[model samples]
Structure formats: structure tokens, C-alpha cells
Target: MVEIKDFKASDCNALWNINRNAFRKSLKKESYEEFKNITENSIGKVIFLENEIIGAIFLKSQSEVGTFKVEKFFICPKYQNRGLGYFILTHLPEEDTSIKKIELDIDESSLKAKKFCEKMKKEI
Candidate 1:
């Protein structure tokens, strides 16, 4: 079963591993620092199955009107296509009552991301 929980400091290595495997581009040597930067600016979480982290996400509040933007979101490539992404999007709002709106952006070149967002739009 997929589950979401607070991300822990110990999960950094696992998060990096999953990130490296899930993407085609090789991350820079400073990727760890970049990860720290992103997570530090947002609320972070781990998506786990049993005890292993299979994915992760982060959010940053966008405005005073209760708008929240999805700052970072990823699912281990091996765990993709299993409906977990959509599940995360639809359920995020229920976790925080102050979140009256949610937003995300995808690179136009990434068909996968575009499709995912389109699917999320339909699902939510």
C-alpha cells in the first residue's frame, strides 16, 4: 500500500537514489545542496510502501489567500503508472484546511509532465 508521511533527514540518500534512477539526466555534484534548498523552502514528505520510500513531494505556500504551489513532486520511475501521482494531488487539500487552492507547473518540453498535469486536472 502507498502511504505518505513526513520526510526525515535520514531519507536523503534514498530520495537521491530514487531521483537519479527516475530521471534521464544526471544531476550535478551539488544536487544534494539543491535538494536541501528546495526542501528547506517547502513542506516535504516521503511516499512509502511498507518501509521504503518510493516517491517524494514538497509544497510552498504561494499567497495569503490560501494558495499553495507544488514546488516539487516526483515518483520513483519504477513506481510510476500506478495511480499514486493522482492520489497525491487529490488528497493534498484534505490534509490542510487552509489550502484553498493548489497549483503546479511543468516544462512545456516534458510530455510526461504535461500529461500528468492534464490528468490531475481531470481527476481533481
Candidate 2:
């Protein structure tokens, strides 16, 4: 079963590995490091499957805009295309009462992500 939980500092290495493998061609070690550092101190969620870390997402408060920004979302390569991304997005509002609008910046090159978001909108 897949489980979502608060990000933990101890998850650094495993999370990095997931990030690294997920975006091999575009992987940025420094960015992942920064993400790990920030997530360790910030409020975010991590997805685990059978005790193995598989995905990570970070949220930032954008109360000024009345939205919750999805700062980061990454899933390991092996776990992609399994509807987990949609699951995370669908449950974001339940995780926080203050979150009304869910916002994210998707790379223009990532057609799959754009399509996933479109699908999520329909699902919600």
C-alpha cells in the first residue's frame, strides 16, 4: 500500500536517489540537495510504498494569492505512470484546510505533467 507522510530529515538520501533516477537527463544534484535541505525544515509530504520512499512533494504558503503552491513534486521512475501523482494532487486539499487553490509550475517540456494536471482538474 502507498502511504503519504510528513517529510523527514532522515529521508534525505533515499529521496535524493528517487529524484536522481526520476530525472536522470535533467537531474540537478544541487537542486535536489537544496530541496532536501528545505524539505527537512519545511512542511511537505513524502510518499512511500511498502516502506520504500517513492515520491516527494513540497508546498509553500501563498496566502497573498489565496493558494497553496506546489513547490516541488517528484516520483521515482519505477513508480511513474501509476496514478500516484494524481492521488497526491487530489488529496492536497484534505491535508490542509487553508488550501483552496492548488498551484504548480510545470516545465513546458513536460507534456505528461501538463496532461496529468489537466486530468486532475477534471477529477477534482
Candidate 3:
């Protein structure tokens, strides 16, 4: 089963490793710094399958009520294509009923991620 939990200090290293391995090209020094900044500054959460850490998400509340901006989100490369991402996207409302909208920013070049988000939107 997949689980979502509050981010703990102890999760730092595992989350770093997961992000590093998941988006090898994107986790360069500058981007890693950005990741650290976001994780430290935002509301962070960790995603797990069984007891293993598999992903992380960082979000910040937007100005609008019940709106949140996704700063970063990633599932470990090894854990992709297992319906976990879809589940997380769809089920977050169950975890926080106050969430009226979830917003994400994706680079134009990241076609795969855009597609995934689109699919999730359709499902929703």
C-alpha cells in the first residue's frame, strides 16, 4: 500500500537520494540547492510504499483560500508507472478536505510530467 506522511527531519537524506536518482539531469548543484530551499521553506510531505520512502512533495499555500502551489513533486524512478502518482493526485482531497485546488508549475520541456498532470486532471 502507498502512504503519505508529514515530512520529518530524518527524511532529508532519503528524500535527497530519491530526488537525485529520480531526476538525474535536473538535480545539478543549482537545482539541488533549489530543492533544499523549497523543502526547508515549504510544507513538505513524504510518500512511501510499504515502509520505504519512494517520493516527496513540497507545497506552499497560495493567496487564494484552499489553493496550494506545488513547489516540487517527484516519485523515485524505480517507483514510477505503478499508479502511485495518480493515487496521490486523486486522493489528496481525502487527506485534506480543505483543498479546493492543487496547482503545479511545470517546465515546458518536461513533456512527460505535463502529460502525467493532464492525465490526472482528466481522471479528476
Candidate 4:
């Protein structure tokens, strides 16, 4: 089963490793530092499959009320190509009914993410 939890200080390394692996192809060495800085300010949630951490998501409140912008979101490379992403995206609203909308900016280099987002749009 998949579970979601609030990010804790101890989960930093685990979450960083997941994000790093997921974007290894698109991010340069220096970009990781930027990621750390950005995540520090955003509200984060960790994704867990059973007892293991599989992914994380960071969000920032948008100017529009009840809207949140995704700052960083990634599932570990080992867990990709499963239905987990769709499951999490679809169920996120259930975790917080106050969230009226979720928005994100995908990296142009990651066509897989783009396609996934498109699929999500069609499904929703």
C-alpha cells in the first residue's frame, strides 16, 4: 500500500536521494544545491510504499487562494513506470480538501514527466 506523511528533518537525506536519482539526467551537480535551498522553504510531503520511502513533493502557496504550486516532485527511479504517481496525484485532494488546485512547471528536458502530466490532465 502507498502512504503519505509530512516531511520530517530526518527524511532529508532520503528525500534528497530520491529527487537526485529521479532527475539525475536533467540536473547538473550545481543544480542540486539549488534544489536543497528551494526545498528548505517549501512545505513537503514524503511518499512511502510500505516501510520504504519512494518519493517526495514540495509545494508553495500560490497567490491565488486555495492554489498551491509544486516546487519539486519526484518518485525514485526504482519506482517509476508504476501506477503510484497517478494514484498519489488523484488522492492528494482527499488529504486536504482545502487545496482547490495544484500547479507545477515541468522541466522541458523531461519528456516523461511532461507526458505523465498530460495523462493526468486527461484522466482528471
Best by TM-score: 4
Instruction: State in Å the error of residue 1, model 4.
Output: 1.0
Q: How far does residue 111 in candidate 4 sit from its true spot (Å)?
A: 1.9
Error of 1 at 118 (Å): 2.6
**lDDT of candidate 3 over 1-124, digit per residue (tens):** 8888888878988898898776665423436567687888988879988999999888799999988887778899988888888888777768777777788665343566777767765665
On residues 1-124, what C-alpha lDDT tens digit does candidate 2 reach at each position? 8788888778877887887776665524447658666676556888988988898987887757547677667899888999889888877678656667777765444566667666666765
Residues 46-120, model 1: lDDT tens digits: 898887799888888885687778877888987888888888877766765666777877634456767887777
| Model with the higher TM-score, candidate 3 or 4 | 4
lDDT score, candidate 2, position 8: 74
Give all candidates' CA lDDT scores.
0.75, 0.75, 0.78, 0.80
Model 2 residue 102 distance off true place after TM-score fit, in angstroms? 1.3
Q: What digit string (tens of lDDT, one per residue) describes model 4 on residues 1-124?
A: 8988888878887778788789778744435568777678887878999979999888798899978887777999989999888887777778767667788665566788888877776754
- How many pairs of residues collide in model 4? 0
Instruction: In model 2, state the lDDT of residue 72.
Output: 68
Q: List the residue pairs that clash in candidate 3.
A: none
TM-score of each: 0.83, 0.78, 0.85, 0.87
The positional error of residue 67 in candidate 1, measured at the CA in angstroms, is 2.1
Q: How far is candidate 2 from the true structure (C-alpha RMSD, Å)?
A: 2.8
Question: Which sequence of candidate numbers ranks them by TM-score, best first?
Answer: 4, 3, 1, 2
Off-target runs (Cα >4 Å) in candidate 3 are: 26-31
